[model samples]
Target: MKDNLVDNNAYTYYHTVWQNGDVAPGTHYLDVTANDKFEGIVKVYVTRRYDADNDHVKAFAIAGANDGSEFEKVADVELPNAVKAGKAEAEFTIAEGKSYSKLRFTVTSTTLERGYWHMAEFQLRPMTLNADCKNATYPEAFAAITKALEEANKAVGSVSVEDIAALQNAYDEYKKAINPETGIDAIGVETLRNNAVYDLQGRRVQNIGKGVYIVDGKKIVR
Candidate 1:
């Protein structure tokens, strides 16, 4: 993917880069795992091959995500004064401590003369994280949580009631163990059982109505 950008090859005829024949809005996704190492900044390169009749991309919105499933908008670029012909490039700095492995670019309201959207190159350059600040503990915990959430999400339709309750209980316990400021575990299971309510999946709740819930990690139907 990195070579495609620096090679100076115009992707006008074929689908070398991401190009669409239709003028409608389209979204393009790119995985930047090879370039991103919890980086702090990302540089984007967009090369336009030809421009006639004022045909060009209007507005583009960029979004990033750690896990490909969910994405958050990172940058919004508007070309009010359309470019005639040339390469358009921009550099975006990520949040102080945040990083993303995947990026999505959506182009909206493009003007096409030949009924095609042309993009010669789309490249990403991510800044490397410092070696001294690298920590594996947080990432391991995050991976475990992500895996649990993925399993919960996959069990939406096929899981049994008991299975759901067990999964929820596990999640609640995990949350309690990780939350340093909450100190939920210090409150004692007996007190939590008396005060808190559990949802059908065994998650603890407050002020819940008539339904299945979990108290002290035990499932109860109310």
Candidate 2:
């Protein structure tokens, strides 16, 4: 635990490559525990093995468990090579949206050779997504928050708290206007006053205009 492979420092690897050409292959398993529950992980990255002599892992599978039991396979990938000399970085992505507190990776060594696995820093990232507002009752309020997010993303260093507060204030003001829940909706024909009907505007209506109207002490829509 002192030299954690997932520390992101990349100074050392898991260092399982202890066997020679006469040794058997290895299947390495690595796991990370989190203090909080995460929905999913993105950006799966591992530093490729440095030397050419070590038998490395060519493919890996990821699994997750919520209660530290019954792990479910979330994703897997076959690497281009177990070890490379050119670069120390390899990239992969996992898009599983299931909740978990423990994430584990299963790395299998390349076949027909000595078994071992080595990699620099193993990195994974979890993300929180914005709430959906497409079908919200007051969409404009959420739209303002989306606009603020767009502006913040465009200018990374300069974030305006005043802009965010303004958007929040707008949403709060809109909330006040839609209060006093009268839980009544208009439905049915245009008007029903014994063959005569009237709209909310107290006007004589005969056609279906899709407007709220009063009929028999109740609201109705045609």
Candidate 3:
């Protein structure tokens, strides 16, 4: 069940820093539904990709749902060229200041390369902080995140990526303020759901342990 493909169940947050990439294009229309939801713009990131043409988004559309019912078409968006991280983003606003629980969309790549569309990693999000915090485990900490999210979404004129990133940092800081655990912070929880291999000790093990390890969100014992 694990390969160099994007699995809606397994695909999660990845690094934005330039590094050797494992991104590969799918053979079909790339449609994904976010586990969390936010208002404002949506962005995707592709790192270390060799072809630019394969990264183009053909048709982009968004749907939102608050009650987990059928997602109503909220916007037919036009994408903007990414200012950073070989990314592509679409700006959309939810009506009536609604926060959706299901944010679903379809992204078709403009071109196909050797059956690979080079969608790279859809890794752009400063949205994690915007999830409702009223009933959260750490309401006090997440309230700060909510405030940051509010400023970013309601800002006058256009909100820059830097401004959005500041919100993300606030999310990270508040997560720490709440103190989820003694070890790693909750910020890396998304990164944990990836294709990398790790051993029993929680140490990332590479180029070894072909079996008896975890990769692509699956247990391999071959």
Candidate 4:
């Protein structure tokens, strides 16, 4: 279950046993590596069995740091109103334009008698303007892709590769239709017939490559 939490497989979960003696009424920390400064939303998936009245977490706080030593509080998330027997998820949106390389989750208090923690997954997604399909020539296609991505992001359990691939395909189509150079329509360019492609940043490329790329005005993969 510990492996599952870190493996991005949300279907599995980790729990605290009463006998572990690890549960205590003190602050617990989780360190997350973001690699570089970034601004995004953080999501935590946790479960509480109402079998015990003290099964829920009481307070949660998130902090961030650039050097991983000095940290500043980024958010203080509100606890859920009602505690259920099954797993539930919550999202904490980071302020726009704020950058941090390291993130930490500090669980200040818990309801469990032993102070044990139970969690299924944790995720951080970077903020993107694509959610609004701004500057998109093919709004419909872009909107579809955005919807798919949102659904994938909100998924609670294991997410299939096929689901992600389909979303990527939709995004590629929209990228192909919107000329990156102009940020406008792709009327003059015949992307399907043109072999030349460009990366998401508008740099012309000879190959589609593995990452997302723009052909004509549409986004495609090699």
Leading candidate by TM-score: 4
Give one digit per residue, the lDDT tens place, for model 4 in 35-104: 5565666566555543444456666678888873698888876556344434455777667777778887
- List model 2 lDDT by residue over 150-207, tens digit each: 4533443454566445544653454454342422122123335355555433444544
TM-score of 3: 0.40
Taking the tens digit of each residue's C-alpha lDDT, what string does model 3 give over 120-158?
Answer: 345445433444442255667666766775575445357
TM-score of each: 0.42, 0.44, 0.40, 0.50
How much is the lDDT of residue 84 in candidate 2?
Answer: 48
lDDT of 1 at 78: 58
* Model 4: per-residue Cα lDDT at residue 189: 60
Candidate 1 — which residues are off by over 4 angstroms? 1-6, 11-23, 26-33, 50-54, 79-85, 112-117, 127-222
Regions of candidate 4 where Cα sits further than 4 Å from its true position: 8-11, 15-22, 40-58, 79-87, 93-97, 111-116, 128-143, 149-222
Model 1 / residue 68 / CA error / Å: 5.6
Runs in model 2 with CA error above 4 Å? 1-11, 21-26, 82-97, 109-115, 127-222
Candidate achieving higher TM-score, 3 or 4? 4
**Model 1 lDDT per residue over 46-136, tens place:** 6654434434555667677886368787777654432443556666766777667776666654555222234545656453435542223
Could you tell me the lDDT of residue 55 within candidate 1?
48
Q: Which ten-residue region of model 3 has the weakest summed lDDT?
A: 1-10
Candidate 2 vs 3: which has more lDDT: 2
lDDT, residue 102, candidate 1: 73
